[model samples]
Target: MPTKDHYAAITTTLLVWGLSGALFGALFVGLYQVSWSLGLPGWQTLLVATMIAAMTTSAFYSAMPVALVGTMAGVLASISYLIAFGLKAELITIAGVAGVAGVAAGSLYAWMVTRGSRPLAEILNGLIAGLLAGGLLVLAFALTGWQVNMFVLAAVAVACVGTLFQLSDGWLVDRVAHWLPAMLSAPVVAGVIAAVVGASIWFIGGTTTALLDDRMTAALEEILSSIPSGLLGGFVGGALSGLLLEFLGFRLEAGR
Candidate 1:
């Protein structure tokens, strides 16, 4: 039977992650619009946007370590974006790059949230989680192209990497306790959960975008329409996943 705490976790995760996704979608599209309108370089715009999001992560938790960790995460993410633009990479390539960057950012997030405790363990586990999360994103991009939007994928991937890294010692330890230590188990669990959640969101958002595109007038318009599609998918998928994860005994720690 579901307890009151379970219901609360479900409600909270749904609202928080859903809003987070919508915000990410808006920021992503908004940056593109700014780049187009101002004739600004895409790399420059991406850098600015990534920095803002990175800093916002620490700020969101009101953590004291925001300065160092946020700056590092922002720089890492921005560099990936710059590289992607320079290479004129396809969506799959971009997704892979985003996963690598997400791992670094997530590690930083864990460090901050835990107030610098267990540095080596957190980073190593985060790396393993990254491989899983990154591969999943690559697969998702290959399947859906731009229908789901990169922002939503990256947001969920990065956030999960951090949260899952934190959880490696809890339930995951039991599942892999026979073969692996707590640190190793964290990544496996985190990666799997992230993949499932990310893929589900991709399917939902991509499907919605496809349906919407069928009624649209032009290529550019159809592309632009994905923003709302991402928003809807993020909310619905986030809510559903939150419920499932909570029921399965997954929990996120509040910012310290």
Candidate 2:
């Protein structure tokens, strides 16, 4: 029952976000190279870029109107990174990989939102999934003997929560009467959650490192820090693009 306008909005939003994500992904690759060349921790640079992408995408997605908003946001944000930082063939490969992942993640999230499920169920599912993934990553680091950085982990955690919100907002908005207020408060909640998760990961990683001389911990930490940021960025970017499309009188639910 969606209208023509809605379809248009969704299409435009997806187009914009996809392009942006590819650009960002390239940029991130470049940044990673630069950081590595400069003797900076590759993970730290990646973490910063991811944070930027997440915040930008989240802000845009929350206020925007469109289906597949989260996916678009991810794509666009990734594109931005590519444009700014990408270089060699390997970097290009990474960008492509990220793009595919973004598409898959975005599609799944969009489907969930459109289905209008219970907010609590969605949130719980997201959180559980994230935690399981994160924990596994931590364990992987322990096996490899790596070091963990708290700041990067914190940023990643925040980004993850933000991404979850972006994908589940429709259900959340309808379930909670004070949805707008909650949306407005999301960043703060995300920040706190990120801090807690980050701290917990850091503590666990550190303890494991002390008990076991695994240097792979650092690599795990880096991965954890970056993934959330990338996801967050995509969410925010898609949201913004969707909003812009909506403002132009395009709806993603027209003719229903």
Candidate 3:
């Protein structure tokens, strides 16, 4: 049976990540709005905001320097892609490039965070996690076509990627006995957790009114409209991630 300490840790993780998600979600909307106002493409703005929010959320969760570097790397890659391809790039092309960039960002973050220990396994975990995270971000953007709330979409994606990124570090990367194949298995587990949490956030955010448009044409007044969605989605995702991690045999380190 789980102890009170476990429950407390779960509660803590949920609160911390939820607040973090809300904070980052707001930042995402602001950044996206600014970029959109400057006439950037919807996909381009989404990439910029998503990468920044995801990296910042990662840093908040892990309290690591690699998150800073990861943020820079991801942002630069997004900007570079925009400069090279312009607005004419197809969604499939964007997805492929984003996947590649995510792999690089994840590998770099894993290498730096682990300091070259079990490099292959850690890098593998990063690659898989990053790819999925990147692809899902685009999916979230696409969901906007179906009228999904942008704030919820961003919160769900960022919260999912951020939690999984650090969870793998603690559960698999930090352990020596976890082999290459076993390490590679982390993404499958993380993906399932993310899917559940993402869906919950979607439901929570979807039922409400979307204040701001996620696209470049949204008016300035709508920028702050998604704050509520961000907060709620972040809280739900963080709480569920904590509960799931605890059940999976990982200790939730408070304030870390």
Candidate 4:
């Protein structure tokens, strides 16, 4: 059903976002490395990066300052909890923090964007949704008993639930959400998109390498040295997956 323009928009958007996301991906990963080097907790770095992704992507897609602030608050709240209850941090604690933060971020975005008659209802809905999401994720984890870090799981739940809670009424939003639950439901779509973009980036890189094999290969190597291929690949991967949230109708335009 999409026209040529739609496909064109998709291409352009992917290029720009993919590049930008590469920058973020590389930078965040670098920060994590730095954190590890500095002996900071891995959970700290992971949670912070995850929160940043959630906040930045929400702002980029939703065009809502409120969303950014709310997400920031959510991030801060999680950190504050960790700081306050360092040794006593439990799974419920992480889940509760994620749920509360998600609700705050999602409700604020929904409220500011919708201008609907039921802002409170939406926020409350988000609250319930966040709590339910956190609880469900926790229960799922308990059943399967993932060996991964709890903070990462918390972050995933918050990100997914936050976006879900921010759903506003729109034809496109509803339509897309049926297939993609605000970026969470359709992992395969997001993964496939990211993989394709990454492949494209690598292909371009390979072509450039071939073009300069004889003359400017040194220059190419220098450039690659400066711009890490891994970072670039990360950027493409993030861009591919992050923007799908928008396409999935997570970011609702005003008045449908």
Candidate 5:
């Protein structure tokens, strides 16, 4: 018994969530790279990069009111990276954790914000969905020891950037104003967010690379190679979860 408006809202929410997840993943990648590249100590790079990224991303989507969702997603994404580091003690592990966390957090936040009528139910469902998404990415990473290279990293970054620009200039603004459908706007927003996130991750990786001694650089590279796949996992997981929520009949509003 859904109306056209209802369907439209659901679709838009999914797109936005997915796009946001991807962008956030990219930011983590960039942060990791920057941290390593800068020769800063452990965690210091991550802390600075995350704060900057959170502020930057939040400011860009200030009008969406779901800005907090993005910020929360960022925090969760960072936590994932930290968890990965603790769990596997590998750079790739960190990447995997970041991706899973971003997808889960972003999807859950979007669903909760959009499903205003049943906030509690929506949140419960979203949490389940997020957990599943994160779990899946971790599984995928385990199954595939993906490697990251400069060329591969650059490709992901460019793709995310293209998507981000599309969101900033395209339907995202209109979607926020109720002037356009979320499906159209969400993807665009997700793309931009992904790019920004990727940049942050790259930053972290680069920083890590610089700090290590020559003897450790090769080992670091091997570990960092898993980042690209981790990012992809996070982006896809988030998008799928958001889409799943929409298919199940959730509605989203302009701001939470």
Candidate 6:
């Protein structure tokens, strides 16, 4: 059976992520809106939204580390948006400053979460996770000419995977971790996650966007395309992180 904590975390993630996404969409609806929203850049908005969600899931334990995960994910999402939409110089600067902050924050969080193990390994793992996922988001946007909305889907993917890892004191993650060689488990998990997110984005809004973004609206085609991107990106991310994690001894402790 799942613990109370698992139930709480899932609920928190569901609400926080969902609300944050909605808020972001509403807040950034127009050029004037973006300027009006306290003059903060879109990425900062994402960071704040993610931070709010992370606080809920990470509050009791791993709170700080979880914050790092959210911050990095948001910053990278912003960078991918820039690339996908054709870079605006302002956004590039935003990406750079946020990237540095993300690195510092990620390093601290990795050290906190991984104990005495090399913090760089977990930090790198998170970075690669962002990169692989971001690449897929960029590719999909470039090909289809969709807006930068896939980050919401990516957030769901990360949340589901992260929540799964926290279950039964990491029992679920450990079961999978042990079943596959540490070397291999990372990519499998990553691919599954990316595929799920890709498929999810397709089902959730790709269909609708088809009618919108200039009849560039081939729902079936785009959904089909996302599958491979998910798989390929997942494999790359999984392999790199898996190997590094194994090297860093980043095993989860299960139920007592």
Choose the strongest candidate by TM-score: 3
Residue range 49-110, candidate 3, lDDT tens digits:
65555544544344334334434444455456556755444334443454455446555455
Error of 2 at 123 (Å): 20
The model with the greater TM-score, 1 or 3, is 3
Q: Give per-residue CA lDDT, model 6, range 79-124, as digits (tens).
A: 4544554323332344344444444444454445443322222223
If ranked by lDDT, best first, what sequence of candidates would result? 3, 5, 4, 1, 2, 6
lDDT of each: 0.42, 0.41, 0.52, 0.43, 0.44, 0.35
Model 2 spans > 4 angstroms off = 57-165, 168-256
Which residue pairs in candidate 4 collide?
A: 22-235
Local error of candidate 1 at 31, Å?
7.5
TM-score of 3: 0.50
List model 2 lDDT by residue over 3-105, tens digit each.
Answer: 7976676776565554444333322333343355446754455454444333333333332222134335344544454455443223334334444444454
Q: List TM-score per model, in order.
A: 0.36, 0.30, 0.50, 0.34, 0.34, 0.27
lDDT of 4 by residue, 31-85 (tens): 3443444466645554444434333333334333433444454455555665776
Ranking by TM-score: 3, 1, 4, 5, 2, 6
RMSD of each: 13.1, 16.7, 11.7, 16.2, 14.7, 15.9
3 versus 5: better TM-score goes to: 3
**Candidate 5: worst-modelled 10 consecutive residues by lDDT:** 117-126
How many clashes would you count in candidate 3? 0
Q: What is the lDDT for 182 in model 6?
A: 36
